[model samples]
Target chain A: MKIIACYSNKGGVGKTASSANLAHLMAQSGHKVLLCDLDPQGASSFYFRLKPAKKLSEDSFFTDQDKLLKAIKGSDYENLDVLPANMDFRDFDIFLSRLAKGHSALKKALKGVKKDYDIVLLDCPPTISMLSESVFSCANWVLVPVIPSTLSERTLEQLLDFFTQHKLEKSKILAFFSMVQVSKKLHLDTMQRLGEQHADLLLNTYIPFSSHIERMGVNRAPATDFAKATPAAQHYLDLWRELATRI
Target chain B: MPRLWHSQGEGDFTPLLSWLENKAVQRGLVLSQTEFLSGPLALIDNGDCQIAEQGKSLLRLSHKLLSISQRDIYPLHRKDQPPFDFPLPPRELCERIEQPPAWLLGLAPLRNLQILARGKGRYQQWRLTNRLHKTCGIIYLLDIELNGISAQHFCFCQTYRGFTKSEKLLTSWQRYIKDVFPGQTAGVSEIVALYRRHPLVVHHANTSMQKGRPDIASQTKRWLKPLLLAAFSNEQGIILDIDTEYLHQYRVNMRKARSLLSLCKGAFEENQQQHCANQLANWMQNTNVLRDLDVHLQDQVTYQQILPPHLHCQADKLRHNLQKERQIAQQRLSDQLQSTAYQTNKQILMQSIAQLNDGDKGQKPATQYGRKRLIRQLNKIFVLTGQLHDQSPDDELHRLRIALKKARYLAEFFQRPKTTKRLSVLASSLKQLTQDFGLFNDACVQQQALHGWLDSARAIKRPPSENIEALTLLLRYYQEQKRQTKYKISQHLRLLNDPNHQSALLAATQNLI
Candidate 1:
C-alpha cells in the first residue's frame, strides 16, 4: 500500500479537495482507498458526508489500535472509506511531540490499516510542525497543490529546502497547480515560470478554479460524486489518471 | 447471486418496506429506494447443479448478457464481442459448471428490488450484527418469478464489502428472523430446487446415487432405472451435439447398467434378464463405432504429444480424418436413436423391468444374497489375480481386470453403514488397480488401432510416410507405456493379495452375514 499526503504549508490551495477527489477516483477505478482526515478541519470527511468518528480523540487514535480501525467509516462510494477528523485532532502535534521518536508517530499509528487499503490518503493540515514531520515520514508521496501564485511558488521552494535540510527524499514532493485561473496574467506567468524552473517536480495537469468545487460544502460529497460533469471534477480525474501512471 | 427469503404472501412490498422504514426512523437512518427493473433470466448450471452447490451462485443469462455476480458479464447477443469461453474465472463458481450453455436449466421472469440505507451506521451495523450474512451491501430484493404462475421470492443481496464476522450477530439474526417471520423464510437455492423438481423445468434425469443399503432387487432396479433415464435424457443433447459429456455420460450409464446386469445375475426372471441383456448388448454394439471415434477425437492432444514436432501436420491430418469419421458416426447414432426399431426396443425394455418380480424364485433374502455374492466374487477375483504370471498375455490380464471390476461393482451394490469404512478402503485399492489396467489397455488399443489404420490406408492407397511415421511413434509410445506399467500392475496385485487386506475385506463383509 502507498500513503499519499495532500499537504501544503499554505491553506486554501485545494489540498483537502484534491485529496478527496483523488481518493474517490482511485476507489472508482477499483482500488480500495482510505482517506485519513489528518486535517483537524475535517474538510475531507465533510466532502464524504461522514461525521467525525464518535468519541475518537487524538491520543486514543494513535495509542488504541481498535479506535483508529473502528473510526474508519464507509463513504457513499463503494470502495472508498474515511477516518473522519475530530476536534480532538487539533492536539495531534502535541501528542506526537511527546512521543519517543516523535517524527515516526503517524507511521506507527497508520500501521494497523496498512494492509486493509490499497492507498491511504492523508488530508494533512496546513502547517510545518511535529505532525508535518510525522506526515512526511509516513507518506510515500507528498502531493502539494499550488494555487499558481507567487506566494504558493515561494512555499514550494521552502518545502524543497526543508526536505534538503532534513535529508528527506525531495523526489517525494509532487507539486501541481490547483485552483488555477488561466484568465489571470499573474497566475499564468507564475505557472509558466514554475514549469520551467521545476520541470520534474511539477505535474502537467492543473485543477481550474470553479464554483462547482465550492458547492462541495452544499453537496456534502466529493465533486466527483455530486458534480461529476463539472470542470474541477474532470481535472481531478485527469490528475488521478496521470498520478496512476507515475505511482 | 445472494441468498433469498420469501414472505408468506405476495402483491405487496408495503409491510416489509414499512418495517424497514420504521426501523430506520427508530435508529436515525436514511432509507433510499431504487426503481425496480424486471427481465427474463435463464439460470444455467450443470445437470447436477454443480455451480450453485459450490458458490451459491448461478449463471444468469438476462438482457442478452450472461454473467455470474461479481464475475464476467459477456453480451451473448452482441456479434462484435468474442464468444464466451468455458472454465470461467473467479474460481468460486464458474469452474464447477462444465459447458454452461449446454447446461441451461430453467428460464424465469425476474424482478429486481433494491432497498438502500435507512440509518447512519445501519449498513455496517446490520452486517456486524447478522452472523449468517456473507453478502456485502445488503439490498432487499423482491423477485416475482413465473413457476407455472407468478411466485414471489425476497432476496437479501450483498454488494461492496461483505458482512463483518461476528458470531453474536449470526445467532441473533437466526433467532430474530425465526421469531419475526417463522415458516415464511426460504433460501433462494431451496426455492430454485423446488422449481427444478418439475420435469419440464429440469430435463436432466436424477443421476445422483442413492444412499444406504436396500434390498438387492430394489437397489438394482433403483440404480438401473435412473441410469437408463439419464441416458434417455441425454439423447436429445447428444443429437444436438451440444457437448461431448452428454454422449459420454450416456455411454457411461449404459455401460454401468450393463455391468450391473452381468454381475448380479438371477436378480430377475431368467427369460427377462436374458432379453434385457440382449437388448443392452445390441444398443452398446450399435453405439460402439460412435463412442470409439469420440474417444479418438477427444484424445487428439495425447496423440499429438506422442509424435515428433515435424509430424504435427500429420497429426493434424489424422485428427481431421477422425473428426470426419466422428461426424458420420454421430449422424448414424442419431438416426438409430430416432429409429422406430430402437425406440420400440427401449420402450419394451423399460416396460418389461416393471413387470419383473423383485428377486428370482427360490432366491434367498436380498441382504443374504448380496453378502454371499460379494464373498463369492471376492474369492473369484483373488483366485484370478493369483493365477496371473509375469509373462501373462494381454488377454489374460484383461480377463483379470474384468473380474476385479465385477467384484468391485458387487461390493458397491451392497455398501451399508457398517461396511462403509472397509468398502472405502477396498474401493480406493480397486480404483488404483483399474487405473493401472486402464493404462495397460490403452497401450494395447493404440497399437491395434494404428495397425488397423495402416491396413485401411493400404486398401485405399499408399499412405503418406509422415502419417505412417506419426502412427509408428504413437505405437512405440504405447509400447513403452505397456512395458513400464508391467511392474506397477504386479505391485497393485500384491496389495490386493496381501493377507491383511484379505482379512480386512473378509471382516468388513463378514458382519453382513
Candidate 2:
C-alpha cells in the first residue's frame, strides 16, 4: 500500500480538494482508497459530509489501534472510505512530543489499515510544522499542490529546502501545478519558469482553475462525482491518471 | 447494509407512512416524497440455476432494465430474447459474476405475478447523533413493493465519520425495526429464492434404482418413467430451438433409459424389449446429426485458436455452412418428433413400461439379476480394456471406451442399497477413466466431423481454399489433442487397471448376488 500526502505549505492551493478528488477517482478505478483527513479544520471530511467522532481524541489517534479502526467510515461510494479528522487533532504535534519515536508514530498508526487500503491519501494541514515533519517521514509521496504563482513557487522551494536540510529524499516531493488560470500573464510566466526549473519534479498535467471546483462545497461531494463532465473534474481525472502511473 | 425483511400482514400503507413520518419528525429529519411507481419484474436464472447457485439474483424490471443491484442496472430492451443473446449492461457486475452474458441459459419469461411496486422517492435520511447532537452517520432506507403492497424493505447505513458510529447506529436501527415489525426479517438470498421461479426441466434428478426394492420390473419402470418424461418434456423446448441443452439433455435421458432396458435383459418380453430398444435408437439417431453439429459449432473458439488469423474468413464460411446444415437438421428432428410414428412409439413405450407386470417371476431375484448383468458388463469391459495397448487401433480404443461407458451406466442403474464406500470409490474411478477415454474418442470424432465437412463441401459450389485450409488446421489441432489425450489415457489406466480396483469392483458386484 502507498501513502500519499496531498500537502502544501501554502493554504488555498487545492491541497484538500486534490486529496478528496483523487481518493474518489482512485476508488472508482477499483482501488480501495482511504482518505485520511489529518487537517484540524477537516475541510476534506466536510467535503465528504463526514463529521469526526469525538471519541477519537489526539491521544487515541496514534496509540489505540481499535480507536483508529473505528474512526474509518465507509463513504457513500463503493471502495472509498474516510478517516475523518477530530477537532482535538489540533494538539497532534503536542501529543507527538510526548511519544517516543514520534517521527514514525504516524506511519505505525497507519500500518493498521495498510492491508485494507490500496492507497491512503492524507489531506494534510498547511504549515511546515512538527506534523509536516512526521508526514515527510511517513508518506511514500508528498504531493504538493502549487497554485502557479510566485508565492506558491517560493513555498515549494521552501518545502524542498526543508527536505534537503533534513536529509530526506527530495524525490518524494511531487510538486504539481494547481488552480491554473491560463488567461493570467503572471500565472503563465511562473508556470513556465517552474516547469523548466523543476522539469522532473512537476507532474505533466495541470489542474485549471474552475468554478465547478468551488461548488464542491455546495455539492458536498467530489467534483468527479457531481460535475463529472466539467473541465475541473477532467483535470483531476488526468492528474489521478498521471499519479496512478507513477505509483 | 442490513438484511431486508418481507412484511406480510398489512393495512393501508397510510398508517405505516405516518408512523415513519412521525418518527422522522421526532428526529427532526425531512422525509422526501414522490409519486408511486409500479412495474412488472421477473427474477431469472440459468438452466442450471447458476445465478441462484452463486447466491446472486438478476431481476428484469418492466422488460426495460435488468438489475443485479441498486447501482448495477442494465437496460435490456429485447425482453423476448434470451439473457445470453442481448448485451447486458453494468459490465463491471458481469465481470464480477465471472460468467459472460451470452452463455446465461434459460432466461425465464416475465410472469405477471412477478411485478414489483417501487417507491419513486427514497425514505427520509437519518442522522446518527451523539449526546451532543453531532452528526455521526447517516441511514437510508429503500422499500420494494409487490402487487401494490409494500412487501419488502432494505435499509443501508454508513457512518459519516467512523465504523463505530455506523455499528452503533445499525444496532440501534435493528432494535427500532424489531420494535416496529415483530419478526419478519429475511435475507436477500432467501427473498430471491422464494420469488424466483426455477426452470422445470432441471439437469439433476433422482434416477437411482435401489437393490432391494421388491420387484425389479416395477422398480425399473419407476426409474425409466421419469427419464422418458424428462426426455419428452425437453422435446418441445428443443423443437422451438430454445436452447441446445434441451436437446443435449433429451439425448441423455433417452440413452439412460436405453441402457437400463439393455441391462435388464429378460425383465420384459423379448419382443417388447427389442422394440423399445430399437425405438429409442431411432429417436437418438434422428437428432444425432444435429447434436453433433451443435457440439462442433460450440467449439468456435477452439477453431479460431487452431487456425491462423488469415484463415478466419474461411473459418467463418465453414461455420456458416455448419449452421445452415444445423437448421436443416433441427427442422428434420422437429418434424420427426411431431410425426405420428414418433408420437405412437413414445406413447407405446411409456404405456408398456408403465403397465409391465411384476408377476412375471424370472429365475433370479432382482439382486441376482442385477449382479449377473453387472458382472457380465464388467467382465466385458475389463477384457476389452485389457486388450488396449499403445499400438492398438483407434477403433479398438473407441470400442473399449464405449464398453466402459455401458458398464458404468449399468452399474449406476443397478446401484445397490447401502453400497460401501469402497464400491463408490471404485465407481468414481471408473467414471473418471471413462471420461478420459471419452475425451480421446471425441478428439477422433471431431477430426472425422471436420474431414466429413470438408468432403461434403466439395459437392457444393467450389468452396474457398481458405476454408479448406482452416479445416485442415482444425483437423491437425484435433490430431495433436488426440495424441495428448493418449498420454492422459495412460495416466488414467493406472487407476482403472489397478489390481485393487479390479478386486474392489468384483467384490462390490459379487456381494449383491
Candidate 3:
C-alpha cells in the first residue's frame, strides 16, 4: 500500500478536510484508498458516518503479526480496507510500549499487505511524539500541508529540520502550500520563498482560501463532493492529480 | 389448629391430657387433647390422640364437612393465610406421599434424577411441589463426588427435568472434585439434623469415581467458585469437546516445535561450516543451554506428569536425508574440486557420514508418509520394569514391543523382499534412518519411565522404595540386554547402505508401505 501520511507539526493547516477530500478523490478515481484517521478525535469516523469501536481489544490490532492480511476488514468501497484505530489509541501507545515485545510491534503489525492498497493516508495527530515517529516509520511518503502564514512557514522549516536531522530520505517527504489567499501579498511572498528554498520539494498545486472548505465540516460531507465543480473543488482535484503523479 | 399440647408437669402431653379430662366431662361430644391432622373433624367421641390418614378412628365424625381423609379433596390456592396453617399431612402418616404415582418405587412422590452443567461450577436449584415451583424448600442434604452435587438444586433438577434447564452428566473427575463437594462449606457439622429436617436431597448415580466416599480433593468445591459461576448461564453448555485433542495436540505441537528448532539450528551451522568459519558459536551456545535444560526435564519427570516431550523425533530423519543429499549434490558440485572419497579408506567413513546426512530430496509423497508411519510403529516400545508393588497389565506395554520389532524387520536389509523397481530403491532410503532411531528410542523410553519412578519414590511423598528398587533393577537388566542387542542392530544398520542389501530392503519397505 502507498501510505501517504498528511503531517504538519502545527495545527489548523486544514489537515482533516484535506485527508477526507484526498481519500474521497482517490476512491472516486477507482483506486482503493484507506484513509486511516490517526487523529482519533472521531473526526474521520464522523465524516464516514460510522461509530468508533466500542471496545478496544489489544488483540484486535495485535494478533499474528505475520497474518496481517487476514485482520483487515473491507470497507463499503470495493477495494478500500480499514484498520480503524480507537479514540483511546492515545492510551494504547503507553499500553503497547510497556509490553515485553514492543520494539518491532508496529513493524510486525504492518509487515504484510503493503501491495494491497493503492494509497494509505494517515491523518496524523498534530504532534511530534512516539505516535508521530511510529507513523513516519511505517509511511512510504509524508505530505506536509502548510498555511501560508509566517508561523506556518516557521513550522514547515522546523519539520524539515527535524527530518534532516533524523537522516530520512528527502525524496519521501513533500510540502504543499495549502489555504492560499492570493489577496494577501505576504502569503504569495512566503510561497515563492518556500519554492526557492526547497527546489522540486514544493508541490505545484495550492489549495485556495475558500469558505467552501469550511462548509465541508459544517455539512459533514467531503469537500470535493459537497462543493462539486466549484473553484475550491477544482483546486482539490488539481492537487490530487499533482500528488498522484509525484507519488 | 394442628398444635401440640404441652404437658406442663411432665413437659409433655400427660398433664395436659388430665386437664382435658375435666373439660370432657361437661361436653358430651368431648374432643380434648386430640391431635388436629386433617382438621377439627377429629371430634368423634375423641380423646387424646395423634391423628393420621391411617389412624384409628377414636370417634367417627358424622360431620364430614371438615375431615380431610376418605374423599377426593381439591387444592385451594389461599393467599394471605395465617403463617401457621390448620391443615397438614400428619407427621407420621402411613405413606409419605398422599397420592402414589405408579412410577415411584416407594411412597415418596418424587424421584431423584442427575444432570451435569458441563463447565466448571454449579449455578442454582430448589425443590417444591413438581407443579407449583415454590422456593421455601431447605437444603436437606448435600453430597459431593467426582462428578458434581446431589444437592437441593440437583434434587429439584431430578424431580423436574427442566428446573435446572439443560443440565448434562459430568464427564470428568477433575471438574467435579474441583467443584460441588460440600466439606468446603462454612458451617456443615450437623448432618443428621439437616437431613431429618429436609428430605429432598439425593445422590447422582455414577457421579463418584470411588463410590460411597465424598470425593472432596479440590480446595474450591463450592459448587459455584467465584471465577466460573458468573460466566455461565443457567446451564454451562460447551460448544464442543475442546479437551478432546487436548493431550494429543499438545504432544504433537511440542514435538514439531522442537524438530523445527533443531533443524534450523543444524542448517545454520552447516551453512556456516561450508565456509570453514565458526560464526555459529554464539547460536550453538544458546542451543546447547536449551538442550541441556530439556534433557534435565526429561530425566526428572515421567511422560504422564511433565510437559509434552519436545525432544525432536524427526532429528534422525533430517540428519539421514541431509547426509545423503549432500553427497550427490557435493559429487555434482565438487567435480570441479576433483575430490573422491570413493578412492581411499577414508571413503568408508565419509560415505557413512555422507549417507546419514544428505540423501532424499524429491522422493514421492506416499514414500514420505510411509517412512513416517513405519517410524512411529517402530518407536512404540513401551515395556514395563514389572517391579511395582501394584503391577500394571502387560497388554499395552507388550503390544508396543511387538510393534517396534515388526517395524524394524520390515525396514532391515536381509528381511526385505526381492524386486525390480527404481521407486523401491528411493523408498527404503527413509526406512534405514527411522529403524536406526526407532530401535534406540524404544530403549530410552523404558529407561526413563523406570528411572523416573524410582527417583520420585525416594524424594517425593511416594508409597515406598521397595517397588521402585525392584523396578529399577529390572529396568537396568533390560538396558544391558538391549545394549548387547544393539551391536547386532548396528551391523544390520550398516548393511542397509550396501547396494545389494539396500535393493532388497527397498523392495520390502515398498511392500510394507
Which 10 consecutive positions of candidate 3 chain B have the poorest summed lDDT? Answer: B1-10
Give lDDT tens digits, candidate 3, residues A59-99.
Answer: 44555543234333333333444454566666546755676
Of 1 and 2, the candidate ahead on TM-score is: 2
lDDT of each: 0.68, 0.71, 0.43
Model 3 in CAPRI terms: which quality? incorrect
Q: Which tens-of-lDDT digit does each residue in B256-327 have in candidate 1?
A: 778877766778776777778778888878777776776677678988787779998988998999899889
**Against the true structure, what is each candidate's TM-score?**
0.63, 0.71, 0.31
Best by DockQ: 2
Query: What TM value does chain B of candidate 1 have?
Result: 0.72
- Structural similarity of chain A in candidate 3, as TM-score: 0.86
What 10-residue stretch in candidate 2 chain B is worst by lDDT?
Answer: B110-119
Question: Candidate 3's residue-wise lDDT over B1-513, tens digit each?
Answer: 000110001011222223333432333212222122221212211001122213211111121211122211111122333321212222212133333222222222111111111112121222222121111111111121112222211111121111121121111211333243433322111212232222112111111122222212111111112211111111111111111121122222223222222222222234322321221222123233223233323333332222223322222332344345444533442232133431242244223323322213212232333344444443332111122112323343344334434444323311224433533443364345445545555555556655765676677776554445455554665477456545544454445435566446445544653
TM-score, predicted candidate 3 vs. hidden true structure: 0.31
Distance from true position, residue B226, model 2, in Å? 4.8
CA lDDT for candidate 2: 0.71
lDDT tens readout by residue for model 1, A98-118: 898889878888899888889
> If candidate 3 were superposed on the true structure by all CA atoms, what would the RMSD be?
35.1
Q: Return the top candidate by lDDT.
A: 2
Please state the Cα-based DockQ of model 1 relative to the true two-chain complex.
0.06
Model 2, position A172: C-alpha lDDT score = 89
